[model samples]
Every structure is written in C-alpha cells, then in structure tokens.
Target: MNAERVERIRAALEDAFAPCAVQVADESHRHVGHAGARDGRGHFAVEIVSAAFAGMAPLARHRAVYAALGTLMQTDIHALAIRALTPEEAHAAASRG
Candidate 1:
C-alpha cells in the first residue's frame, strides 16, 4: 500500500468533511494475490467523525464519503470500508470505551 495515496485519501476526507477525527488504513497487504491488488489499486478503511454527518443515514454517510473521494475511487482505490459518524456519536463511542 502506498503511504502517499493513503495520505491523499485522508486529506481529501479532511477537506470535504472537516472531520474532528479521521483515520485511513491501507489493507492491501491482507489482499495480496487477490485480483484487484494485482492491478495496483488499493483497499482502504476509513473512519471519520464530523458534524457534516449529523442526521445522515448510514448509507448516506457512506455515499458522502465516496463522493468526497471523487476520482480516487476510479483510480487509486479498489475498495473502501467506511465508518462515518457525527461528533456526538464519536463522543458517545469514546465515552463507552
């Protein structure tokens, strides 16, 4: 997985969502030898907390993330796993932890 590409994803998300917290993980190592990995695109997981996600449904949240990613989805990224949440949800999760 390319560190530069991962950083690009994080940057894009931050610009789009103004997230309070964001994490981007490259999971391509786990998919080594898979057909998608062979093509050079990467698998990534993203977790973001932002006020922008407030009141959005789960699917809508995911779509918003995908939109934020824009053309990266067609080029650098082969697959994505997203965990999007509002600030309040993030706070609650932290409290639970």
Candidate 2:
C-alpha cells in the first residue's frame, strides 16, 4: 500500500510539473502508532526539481504540489513534506553539498 501510494504521488507530480527530477519517499514507518498513521494513510516526503517552479514562491510551489495530488491528499496521504525547487536551485544545492 505504501509503495503504491508513493508511485501515485510520483506519477501525479510528473504529470503536473514535467519535473527534471522527483523522488517520493514513504516515511510511514518512522511514525508508526502516531495519530495520523492510525487511519492507514501514509506520510510522505517529496523532493522535486522542475522548471515549472522557477518563478514561483515557496507557498505557490506547495500549493501547486497539493493541487497536483488532488484527492490523494485526503485519501492516501496523511502528511506531505515537500522540497520544491527549480533545476538551477537543485544544481546549486547539490554543488554545495
């Protein structure tokens, strides 16, 4: 179930943003027995780099991600941690690391 949710998330983001890179990680195990995880929905983290985010503010980028996820926000995902970045920003961060 968790793996399926991660794939759904990745596919949705890819369709919406045409991302240069995208990773969706299921982090539910770390939160086992937590309140949100009780309902069977999973927690996830996404790191995405896309030109679609180039001129967008952080809030806008988050909103766009939420929008792309649509009903999965209510059904499959209990929480989402997002790192939305443009390709240029991704490269800069990677270079520094």
Candidate 3:
C-alpha cells in the first residue's frame, strides 16, 4: 500500500495507454496475512479507460495492462484486479451514475 508504488503503477499505465481516466487502488491491507502479502508485494485494483482498449477483448485488455506494468508485476505487485474499458464504455458508465 505504498504511495510511491501506487504512483509508479499509475505512471506506467498512463505512459502505456494514454488513458482518459485511471484509478489505482491498493488493496493490500485487506489481504493482511495472505501468502502473497508475506513477500512484501501488494495487491491492486485498477480501472482504466482508454482508446487503446477500444477493440480489445477482456483478456487482451488485461494482458495489455500487465504488459504496461512490465517488471512491476514480478516485483512490486502480487495480484491485480483490472477493469479496462474504452472511452465510449466509460462514458456510458458515467451516464448511468
């Protein structure tokens, strides 16, 4: 749940996708004594809206996000929950809210 690590994640994703919106949340605290947390890595949830995901399938989007994070996936991050969407999907979601 380190702020620095979270910021790094956000920066990397932004650089890769040029996302219109990105939200990164550390969920490590909830995992507490979980096995992965024991190793000092973190769990994170990310919601990103971008043109890069426009025609991608769900799995492809997740893979893209993973690729964006690069080595961070093996170092700073233990688990990731991703909600990737195209700009139009994000706009639709916003309207619903």
Candidate 4:
C-alpha cells in the first residue's frame, strides 16, 4: 500500500517536475482511528523540492502536484499532505531554521 503510493507519487513528480528531492511518507499510523483510514486507504505526506516550481505560486504548485496524481486520489489515496517548493524556497526554509 505504502509502496504503491510511493510509486504513484514518484511517477507523478518525476514526469511533471523532475524533482531534485522527493520524499513521500506514509502517515497512516498517525491516524490509526481517524475517519479516512477506516477503509484502509493511505494517508501521505509529500515533501518535494524541484526547479519546476521556480515561478509558480504555492497554490499552483500544489495543484500541479495533485493533478499529476490523477485518479489515485479517488481510488487509493485518502489524504495528502504536501510541502512543495522550488529549490530556492527550500534553501530559504532551511536557512530560516
């Protein structure tokens, strides 16, 4: 299940952003008794840093990633947490902390 989600996310971003860093974490265990996980679907947190997002707004970048995932949202995925950013933004975030 986690493997499938990882593959789907990887394929989506690889095809769309050609990301420099892509990390997909299955956080289903965190919501063991949560509403969405009752049916056994996967809840994921994705952290992606890519050059493709350089000029895009945050909403646009999120939409682009969601679009890339396609039917997986309706079928295999229940919730997705995304931290999508360009390399520069990622660097800024890192420096901030």
Candidate 4, residues 8-63: lDDT per residue as tens digits?
87888788889999998888889899988988788989999999888888899889
Put down candidate 1 lDDT per residue, 18-79, tens digits, no spaces: 99999999999999999888888999999999999988999999999999999999989999
Which candidate number would show the highest lDDT if scored against the true structure?
Answer: 2
Off by over 4 Å in 2: none
lDDT per model vs. reference: 0.94, 0.97, 0.95, 0.87
Q: Which lDDT tens digits does candidate 3 get at residues 30-77? A: 999998899999999999999999889999999999999999999999
Please report how far candidate 2 places residue 80 from its true position, in Å. 0.4
Q: Please identify which of the two predictions, 1 or 3, would achieve the higher TM-score against the true structure.
A: 3
Candidate 3 residue 21 Cα shift, in angstroms, is 0.5
Deviation from native of the Cα of residue 36 in model 2, angstroms: 0.6
lDDT of candidate model 3 versus the reference: 0.95
Instruction: Find the 10 residues in a row with the least total lDDT in model 4.
Output: 1-10
Please list the residue runs of candidate 4 whose C-alpha ends up more than 4 Å from where it truly belongs after superposition. none
Q: Output the lDDT of residue 16, model 2.
A: 100
> TM-score per candidate, in order?
0.95, 0.98, 0.96, 0.90
By TM-score, how accurate is candidate 1?
Answer: 0.95
> In model 1, what lDDT does residue 70 have?
99
